[model samples]
Target: MTSAPPHQSILDKPFVLDLFAGPGGLDVAGHRLGIPSLGLEWDRSACLTRYAAGLDTLHADVSAIRRESFESLPPEINVLAGGPPCQTYSVAGTGTGREALEEVKKFIERLMAGDSDEEIDKELRKLSDPRTALVLEPLRYAIQATRSPNRGHRPYDVIVLEQVPAVEALWVRYAEVLQKVGLPDGTRYEVVVDVLATETYGVPQTRSRAVLIARREGLGTPSLPEPTHRAYEAKEWNRRNGDSAAPVAQPTLCDASVPGPSPAADDDLEHWTSMGDALAEPVGTQHRGRRTPFLVRSNYGSSGIPGRRGVRTDRQPATTVTGRISRFVVFEHLDDDIVYEGARFSMNEAGMLQSFPPDYPWSGTAKAQQVGNAVPPLFGAHLLSAALGLPAPAPEVMREPWIPATEEQRAKLRSHGCGTADDCTARCPRPEDQTPPRSTSRPRRNTASRQ
Candidate 1:
């Protein structure tokens, strides 16, 4: 079967700068849509990933970035985009004590260019420049620094913020600040966007995410896009259900009788065929035995299967790609004999579900990290390009890297052997038992407890 054609973005192209741009997924989408894009990420691994995807990635923290960099950036940057770290506001954080919210509040205040002597003093005490603070601190500084004294102008035409669902309050704070900072009235952000998957656009995943779009006056309020694919009209779909909740028509994974979307063939989907294929390589001895299946399920409903499920939604767009690799939907073969069972979708497949092109090589960083960190390039490209009024980008065209026989990957494969991961012919050799035996001594009871 032939591969899908390159994605045609539904937006006018614009120059974009992706701040805190992990792995350049957003940039790629924009680039494909005829927008010139640049990525800035703090992590070296992430920078490498962006470079491989053909983006001009900078290895610098947002806080450390100087105003000159923005001033000197390629003239095409009409948009500034990023997703700040949401650890303090994250529900999973232990730092949620008073100090956490205080820090996050300070961050929001700084983003609005509000000055506080206490925060400045705290930075001075730490022997650090307040200009180089994390989260919103640098973003605020960048905005202020890039402004021209003579022209009295701002640095960007627009800014986009993406974050976790658990941080709704934080987004509200962001919206508050955006309004105060001269964004035209009614330019507020929505914490939750109703987005459907490939089903609407003709792919197949029930993916949902929150999206926030803010722009300058000329750009106007960004309106949501319309859907192209419908569930009942597609012959591949076996079941159909209209969503009363969906503002637009929603798509299905397949049909009710069939479980999920279709799978790509060995040649088309080879990179996602096995567990190890999801990761570039292991991270240290700590991750040596941590292998994730290419298919995973939640109880028995949603799944993480390879190349089967598409994006799902009918209203807004998808959320950023995440390393929650095991939470995506799965696709099982419908044949009498189930060849790959209990499988979860690989990291690369997860990227695709988010609309990343197949030829978008995710490199440098570990596969899971790269996939998790990447913005859905398609979303970024389509959104920002439309905002810029440029043409769409062409699809990726490149050959796979030549794997030498003596390379480490090949050597390891030879040492162990390769076929189906299901073939357990070469078991992981048990290391010399290092664990100590349980202590035999009984615990002595406290005799003086009568006091």
Candidate 2:
């Protein structure tokens, strides 16, 4: 795996802190973009993934980190970036659960203090006394020891947070807290965008998310990058700033036809081929065989099948990549005889769709956990590079050691017939015992077909 450059003028580059750094997707992207980043994660396997990605990783909980550590590090931290655990705000969560809300509050309060000692005083004031929150004593030392009173208190210049669109409103609180920490009002930040990818950038799959950009020194609130591919178009939502917008290019499952002069292209049809069962339907006469009628998968379904359709595939990007395994579907390639034609995303393929490099090293057994936890590196690269004024790199270029399929994962893929053209039976939680009858014996070839 490629590692950070030799220690030379690290001060010239932006220094970033990545909290809850799962598999280091964001940090990897930032590093590729020439930003120097450090990742903090609690999971050991996650830390390994980050290490494989060429980042300076610390295996520790973000809440456990002290301010003294920051004071000891270089003074030029241009960005404080992280997406804290989303459990509190996640749809599956109980809506700002007490623990999550407390963490949020504590995160803000720590930033306000810029160190541990001040944090203690703040806690004392908030609670009856500092002793009441004694369990937080270590954090107090970390904060106090790291604070730089001589440098004047100030938050990082830019903060980039990613989360589900449904819960983005919760972040206004973070913005509010940052502003209260002496940054100029209004100039402090903006939750500039909340759009669905399927409606805007044309990924074959549909996903939605909310991206928030907050800046310290009155830099323009970050705007969504224009789509480069002719495949998808900019959707003119009623809430959009303008009434009329141009059609953006749509990206296929492989190549995202971006709008720039140099649009990136790829023809890896793995996802298309994998989900063929869900997207394709038979034509012609009745009961050809035990073929199931293709069904569209919905993100909200319990069966974990792709079900929504009739939405334009060429006019917009895909939705946010969710962590839900049951909702995302992949097509399966099939050859006659035993029956074939549909498959779901292999854990690795799912990771790729999320914009992790093809070889992103994933840690742990829960494939869903690894894929869902990754930050879309492409998105992260663009956001962090822009924030730090550095040249951005594409997500694919960042390579790592642990990113390739593990032995066990390889066995899973082999079991699923990843390499062969044979029919593979996938795990479908449906109760239907009888397969859908095949209406036709031959496969019809159409260019406009959901390729």
What lDDT score belongs to each candidate, Candidate 1 first?
0.43, 0.44
In candidate 1, what are the lDDT values of residues 1-451, reduced to their tens digit? 2211234222344566777787666666655554566666666556545544556655554544543344545554556677665444344332332234445666566545545536753553342222113445434633543453432444556665565454445555665566555422223322223333323432223333334555554444444333333332222321333321222112232222222343445323211111122222343222222132222332222234433343322221222345665464443434433423333555444555455654455555467656765555544554454334333332221112212222344334323321222221222211122122333445656889776
Count of clashing residue pairs in every prediction? 47, 65
Name the 10 consecutive residues with the lowest summed lDDT in model 1. 395-404
The stretch of ten residues in a row with the least summed lDDT in candidate 2 is 251-260
Global local distance difference test of model 1: 0.43
lDDT of 2 by residue, 9-39 (tens): 2135567777667777677677566667766
Please, what is the TM-score per model? 0.55, 0.55
lDDT of 2 at 441: 41
What TM-score, to 2 decimals, does candidate 1 have? 0.55
Output the TM-score of candidate 2.
0.55
